[model samples]
Target: MYGIVQGVGFRPFVYNAAKKYGITGWVNNSGGAVTIDLTGDICNVKKFVIQVVKNPPFPAVVNKVRCVSLQYLHYDDFNIKRSSKESDTVKFIPPDMGTCENCLKDIMDKRGKRYRYAFANCTKCGPRYSVIKELPYDRRRTTMNSFEMCSSCKDEYTTPRDRRFHAETNCCQKCGPSLVIINNKGEIQKCEDVIDETIELIKNGKIVAVKGIGGFHLVCSGRNKVVIGELKNRKKRPSKPLAVMMKDINTVREFCEVNEKEEEILKSSKRPIVILRKKENIDLPENIAQGQKKLGIMLPYTPIHYLLLEQLDVLIMTSGNISGCPIEYKNSSALKNLKNVADYFLMHDREIYVPIDDSVVKVFNGEECIIRRGRGYAPSAEHMEVQDNIVALGAQEKSSISISKNSYVYTSQYLGNLQDFNCYRNYQYVIKHLTGILDVNPKIWVYDMHPLYVSSAYKKEGIKIRVQHHHAHMVSCMAEHNISEKVIGVIYDGTGFGLDGNIWGGEFFIGTRADFNRVGHFEYVDIQGGDAAIREPWRCAVSYLYFCGYDGKFIKNIDKNILDAAIQALNSSLNCYKSSSLGRFFDCIAVLIGLKNFITYDAEAAIALENIIDENVKETYKYKIRNENNVFLIEIKDILQGVLNDINCKLNEGTISAKFHNTISKLTCDLVLKLSKIYSISKVVLSGGVFENEHLLKAVYYELKNNGLEVFFNSKTPINDGGISFGQIAVAEAVTKKQSRE
Candidate 1:
């Protein structure tokens, strides 16, 4: 069968297969196939065909390979022929794959020709999509075009028996990408010798920004607290943990424990930074994780990283970009943009055409933790039974695009919340590339119910479907579980634009994974401008305390300056927004206990509270609930009042946090029990971003099961807003399918 597959070394692989089996043919890449003119025995030809089809080459995806009718060659041998450009319209482009074990050994092996070469890679390893500027995945079509193979390397490439033969990324120090180093002053420290100098600088406690596969990473000596601190100061990334990269699985175990599942994810082609818990007594910089208990650690995924870290032993390789900005890919861009952040710039010549940020994850319950899906995890098409192609632009925050083409869902790499032009621009770039890769012509567009979301605008060209925020939250868990049956969805999050023009967070639903009907939600309060209370937690604190009959005494009991600020904050109607938000309620609880009236980041107060609580501890008091209109409502006002009286007491923060966590758990269980008895249903699915708190997750899980109810959560993707888009798409698909049926 003639097709578009020539010039990709398909012929050489066929020739090699012919040698493996006793066959005679003249194979060539004429029209994208092993065009064979053979006069061979049927059985040998059959074996040749099978081998050719099964193992064409390292770089081949082989979308369609079919044998043709009888064509006889009066030749005694199988030979390779030059390629022609006449192929079909459809071209199967392969995404980037990681280094193969053979290539890794060859790089590290002393006897190998490509010894200790940072750029040593082949078709099975190294950059693919990121380095490719055009299709047909050749040296000319890639960043490697600048680096012509030498005579020795060329022989290996042309040898049919050699694995490196025709490998696209084959390179060595003499003819491949070069490295250079510059100090903070923009002066080249070592123009000709970078790898060794960069390693020495890192070992000397200097932070160097190095260009990587998808972007730049600010590298520093992880073992040096002072250097890490300096890197943190320059990066301006406070509190958030800096990711630490180790050598290998063994090194990872030396720093942290890795279970079978954790090891599996670590070794996967998409080598994401898996946030593993620190093994006891493993000393690391305090700033690495800040106040958190677990350290975000990742193993080396690339040969360059392997070589660099192998020399330095341990280095703190944080993302090579400004905080909240896209990762830097180009050396010039990193040099220019990272001038203010990095102490040194480690430059490289290979071009980065596609930006892929490091994937981040955690492991629990013996399964993979997908905190941020990118690199190896991305473009991993989630096969669902969808009817048509649709584009679902996730929310502006923690952005991801879900593309559905006849049941396969392909989500783009993690695009951060569209707060800046950089984020928005990257969002556009990722979307364009993603649409190109999937070859999807979407007719229907999906978005979060919020009309003003950037993602909503992206899909303006299609039949737009607005998905409810909490409903989508539930649907995410449903999607993760691949649940086709109906179940109760216990959904709670920070905030979502409610159907009634109010802000919603805490919600409960009874529906299938596809569709959910809002059964009960937290009591609607006037969220004045939606964002007013989020920035100022004191407003939420004051509102909750005031509703519970406190004349803001908790503030007065504190410093006069604090009390005055609280008074002014309460008086300013412009700053106040009434809400029954569970997250804000947690913030209010933190405030009521005189813990914090202000926060520097989103979920700061809540996260701090979780940090304080002992998972082994339990809430001494139980929560009370009120049933309204066949829905159970937990009277949080009572909890607010009780903590108000104990404002000045030496209150146990753990107890308060536990009480808060347990109150929600008890309330949820009570709701499920009462609702199920009323409706004769016995299953509940717990979802939402709030469940990321391990303490609360376990509490809710056990309490619900103790009450004879089935519970499900995001064991894979986060239970946070990061998972919102998946849920939105599921809901949109259901709506679309139901509409079609109607």
Candidate 2:
């Protein structure tokens, strides 16, 4: 058995199961794989194997189990032997798990040995990826090695009957790491009751930076408008929604409409921030999520978080970094960087080796779509049955790295955009960190085709393969489904370097990973001030208006100076590039329909547009498709004209947004059907970040399915740039094979 078996109580589970079936030998970790040697009755041994496979540890992912007829040494009973680190394949390190229910009860129970202990955890739950230094996942390989376990705690660990038997992270108040409260003046407050003092400060609406499992979170009372406003102001985040940490499902239901699926995801051990629709006229402060209709809510994942939430109803728990920078994990860094933002600090002694942010997820079409894969969801390998010794550097935005081993591509956590110097450094660090931990030395390096990309510039000592951006997006969807056959891929996202040397976003391609042909795409429009257009949606709106043959006089209510400059740029074609980006199209529509013209973050305008979608409005605007030498041009000028007519008719933004979305969806089906007739391809693959919009995906998915076409979108891997690395890996292998054949 392999894959996340270590550090997740799999050994104990095997021991318990073996004992139940009267199979005797030994079970131990050999690098990444769990080795079991047993000799007993044939039926009992078979039952033991079945039980092990059927009911492994909660967090363990048993990828494959192999049974062999071994010359077993007869033993009286089963025993967990010392782990041996002797294997070519490195073991998978489990992500930090949320505190389990039993441990929660332990901390709450007055008579319990770990009562009120902030670091109380067992084998089933606690920090793993964050604190881990090396493999075999023993106590010494973790930060817990610094803390000497007390006799009582040691007894719980060594006792086979105990739930925490061989639990590497088990600790009590007397032996484990302790917390300290620091005042606003950078002076340590001599307080015995740190939790109580921290709770009191937050109750009074004072913001506190609390050290958590992966990093520090700036927490304040969510109900208090002043505190929430202060947090937003200090963080330099105005309209972006702040995630809230609730006590339990009951508190979450009070503020947000909790469906059954969302409730389960919130309570799951991963404990990702589940984006839930807010209850109409909820009793919470409006400033908590501001203009957004949905609230990002998460349950306590750590013992300290649980302890804090036990007293508080709701807290505005957000990453403790000054917006745009990576999360603050080091105590010294948190104390120094967050001094101005947080009034007080609740810090712990336990060191976090890796800085992992909280993961964010949204329920889409009854499936959990990961927006930000971090914390409890990361450092988890996405397996692929491919050749080893390859590394794929992900896209410039939402960066992550993928290392391929025998049939497994262990992708790194959500490394922020490589655009920032600090985030670039984070990307570099994670590449080195993950490669070191996974013991991977790549012989082949894969990178994006864009020359200016920081990831492409990395000096890797290997054969390099540069893959086209949208092809990688399409291939990523293919790789997730393990598809080898060619399919019609409709890739829509912000931007990607096209093979024809233009910025391609809305793309239609038909092929396998080896090669792809651009069958059709949206007609190119001039992008005035390349990066500048991305920062401000108004520029895109003006560009689209100009493309629709609208003069400067048509740009009423918009800034005259900006409009004039954009028009000048478009007329002269100065510092302007052609792009067929669907993302830019959305941005243009978002601004045209009276959404935010300037964005504080990436995809802000698009998100606002998606949020205001009126699902009941099924009417789609007319669109034109013309084939130019087999490359179909999807003209959106007519769609924009329809939108203008709707706006002139005083239609609300929601209705316009609905019409715009439906038009795009219809256009997708129309283009696919046209291509299907020509290429005889029926498999339609939807990929890229634009598909992260559930409304658009659902519309396209159901429409294609109803039309007797098989539709496949990304489920295992991300549809965004986060999954680009995996696509890079797939393309690399396919290209290599093709080259070898040639």
Candidate 3:
């Protein structure tokens, strides 16, 4: 057994299983693996092994199980042996899980000892990665070590038949951490019942910073628009959507459309925030999710959350952080940082070892794409077959890190953008923590080709290799699917450092993990003001218009001074760089179709455009591809001209958006088919942040699959820069092995 077998009561489970099967055996934790020895009748032994493999503890994720014959040294009975501390820790750190159903029942039972216990947890669920300091995952090595179990809890832990037997973090109200309510000045309040007081504050429409498994969350009543607006104003968050913690799946269905898959995910053990489309005329406050039609919602995951939410309809649960800082984890830090934002604080004495944000997900084409991987989904290794130790420093935006050891890739939690000081510090801390915990010394260090990336600045002693951004995107998809052979990779996203010293985004590559050739790409356009152009779409709009041979005066929506400056900069190529970014093109179209010329957040323009896609319009605009010297250049002048003509004819933004999306999808499909014929390949992988757009993904997926091509997409990791570390690991490991052979 490889995954989540340590902190969870796997040994006790094995002991019980052995007793039931009448087999003599010994079980113990070795490094991170579970080692078992059994001696008995062949049939019963086989039954025991099958049962162990099939019915592991609810929190245990058994990746593989192997049996080997050993000379029987007769033992009278099976027993749990002491874990070996000399070996390197091989067990994966399971993410903090939501309170399990059994634990919930204990909390609800009035006569039970655990009734209303806010920190109620069993072996099957509760904090793991966030509480662990080191591993063989023993009780002494966790944050719960200081809290000695009460006599009653100890009795339950010692009994083999008890559900709490050998539960590492087991505790009752008498022994476990307690809740504390504090006022705005950080002074403890003398409340008889902390839960009731916290409920009263929230019911009165006051913001409270509630300590959770991972970190603190600023919470307010979800139904109160004024309170929600106040939260937004205090947090200095102008437009990004806020997530709501509903009472349950039933409450979610009332506010948003829930397919079976969405409902299942909402009720899952991970309890990640799921983005669902809002129902028509549902009358949800528009300020909750300002610009988008989708609502990010989650169910109460912890005992404290359930206790408070049971008294209210819903709560606005957002990470407790200022605009650019990481989520506050420490009680002192929460009080100091959230003093202005939160009116009161609901805190606990239990410490969080590592801060994590809530994971976010959205269903696209009936599959889940992880927008942000954290909390319930971090520190878990995905199995992969590779040689040597490797460290992959991911892209700058949506940054994360990964380490490869013994055929497993352990990706870190969501480390926010590398630009902010606190986020970068967190990134470094995660790197050190992962390396130390796994005892991995990477022989190869991988980074993006972009020289200015903060990740690229990391200095380490290894065979350093630089990978192109879009290529990493494609291989990230391939790694998730476990593809070892070559495929056609259609990579589209924001900007990346191109091999030719230009910014590349829209690209098609044909190759394996070791090497690839860029077979096709979008034609280059100038990004005036360089990085500044990303925040203001009008600069890209001007560049597109100029390249399409349109007069500057035609762009009347932009301010006169800004337009004049942009045109002059474009003509002179001043402080401008060439880019083949599909994202920039989308920005141009978004502005041309009358969306906001300026955006407060990244991908706002593209998201706005995607939100209004007219599914009824099936027509695609024209585009021309030029194959000069075998370097295919996809020119979008014809497409832009058609869009301009449509604008002149007074077309709705939805129709224009649909036509634009369809044009790209058709162009990509046409390119893939043409290349498939030329190269004799049938497998295609779609990746990059742009693929997060469901409309384009579905359109291209149908076209390619209908044309008899096997399509692959990202499932394990994100399609954005967050997945870049995984791709870097795959490519670097392969490249290192190839070089060693040479």
Candidate 4:
């Protein structure tokens, strides 16, 4: 059996099953798979195999199981054997799981050995990918190897019937890792109880860096605006929303609305931060989300988190890092990097071999969409039909790496953008670690087509293939849906290098996994000052107005000198690049409606626009679709004029935003219907960061489906750049196969 069989109590479950079925067999971990040898009656063996395959232990994902008839040596009884050092085949290393109910009960039991233990874990729940250093996932190959189990723990580990049997991370307070509270000056603070002291510090409005299963979290009281502002100033994070760790589901329900699907994702074993809509007139500070309408909320997923949150209702739990840096995982690094940002440190002795961020998710149209794939939902592997060993270095932003081995593509967790030096180094480290753990030697290297991307420029000794960015976006959704035939693809985002050497974001294509033809796209507009147009929305606004035969005199709250410089750049074509990005289009509208002048984060303007939309508005702005040389161009000149007219009439921002969104949705449906009619295709795939907006996604999804066509979006992988690496792998395989066929 392969796929997530290691370190998940699969062997113990198998051993127990064999004894129950009156069979003699041995089970052991080999590489990443569980191997079993059985000698018994044919019917009994078949029944045992069926039971094991059908009913795996909690959190165990059995992807494939194979059985072969062989001459079995006579064994007296079933037993668990030692692991083998076979490294030929590939198997999955499970992602780190949230604390299970059984383990939580053990921690709460006063008479138990692990009562009130901060590091309490069982086979069903604990760190897996974070602490693992090698294959065959044994204690000796993990960070837990340093701790020596006490006699009590050793007895439980040796007992076959015990839940902790062969649990590699099993230990008590006496033998496992312990926590300590320290001042920012690196001196250990003498305290009676560390958990109590940490709780007291947080309640007293002190910022504490709490080490977690994957990395460190900078935690504070979320309800206190003054403390949150102080944290923002200290961490140099100005406007980005900070995630809150609520005590329980009831606390989450107190502040935000939760539906059935959202609640299921929140209380799941893989606890991720769910973006929820805040209730009207809630007591949360405006600075928490900084003008956004949603809040990122999560429940305590670890024993230490449960202990710390026991005395507090809510705490601001953000990544322990400065702005534009990867999360700090090592104790010494945390001390050195975060000493100035944190007031106190909740230190632990357990090592984190890999640092993973918290996963972010949201529910749209009753489906859970992953925004960021990390701690509880990362190191995700999927089976694919491919011939060669492949490694796909993903795009620059939302960086991740993927490796293919044994016909399975394993994608790494979300690594931050590679623009920062520290993030770049961490990206390299993750690549080496993932490839080493899976033992994959890359015969093919795949990357994006953008020459300026750090991932595209990476040096490796293999056959290199550069894939178009938006095509990868389209195929990513297609591959997730197992679609191999041709379909209409709607790909939109902030930036992608076009085949004509321009930036492409708003795009439509008719394509298969191997190839695609550009069918329609938004018309190109000049991005003044190059990359600065992305940061300053007013610049994009001026560019759009200039192209629409309007002057910048009507715009307000922008520096006159900078505005003139932007116009000059546009006029002379200096540092101006033509972009067809719908994201920039949203930014332009955001500035025109006086939503924001500048942005501090990615998609800030677009998010603000989405937040103010009135779902009841049925009106849409005028748009023109022109067929220019067999390719449809979605012209926004009329739409720009409509937005200007609304601004002149002093219309409400909500109405304007809603009208613009509706126009896009209607135009999308119209364009897809036209293409479907022309090409005789019935399936439409939508993929990109723009689809992260729930309103647009729902509108486009249902509109296409209502028109007698099949609609698909990414569910298994991210719809953003985070899923680009997996898509690159898909494209590489298809291209290679096509080449061989030719």
> Which numbered prediction scores highest in lDDT against the true structure?
4
The sequence of per-residue lDDT tens digits that candidate 4 reaches over residues 45-145 is 88998889989897787888877878758999999998887767668887898899999998889998888899999899889899999989889999999
Candidate 1 lDDT for residue 161: 81
Q: Least lDDT summed over 10 consecutive residues: which range in candidate 4?
A: 85-94
Better of 1 and 4 by lDDT: 4
Question: Which runs of model 4 end up more than 4 angstroms from their true locations?
Answer: none
Model 4 error, position 679 (Å): 0.6
The stretch of ten residues in a row with the least summed lDDT in candidate 3 is 85-94
State TM-scores per candidate: 0.87, 0.97, 0.97, 0.99
Measured on C-alpha atoms, candidate 3 has an lDDT of: 0.88
Question: Candidate 3, residues 317-352: lDDT per residue as tens digits?
Answer: 999998778999999988888999999999999989
Over 112-216, each residue of candidate 1 has an lDDT whose tens digit, in order, gives 777777777764567766776654456676778888888888887888787666777777877778677887777877444567777887888777888777778
Worst window of 10 by summed lDDT in candidate 1: 84-93
lDDT of model 3 at position 537:
86
Better of 3 and 4 by lDDT: 4
Candidate 1 similarity to native, TM-score = 0.87
Residue 415 accuracy (lDDT) in model 2 = 83
Candidate 2 structure quality by residue, lDDT tens digits, 444-510: 9999999899987798788999999999999988988888998999999998998878999999999
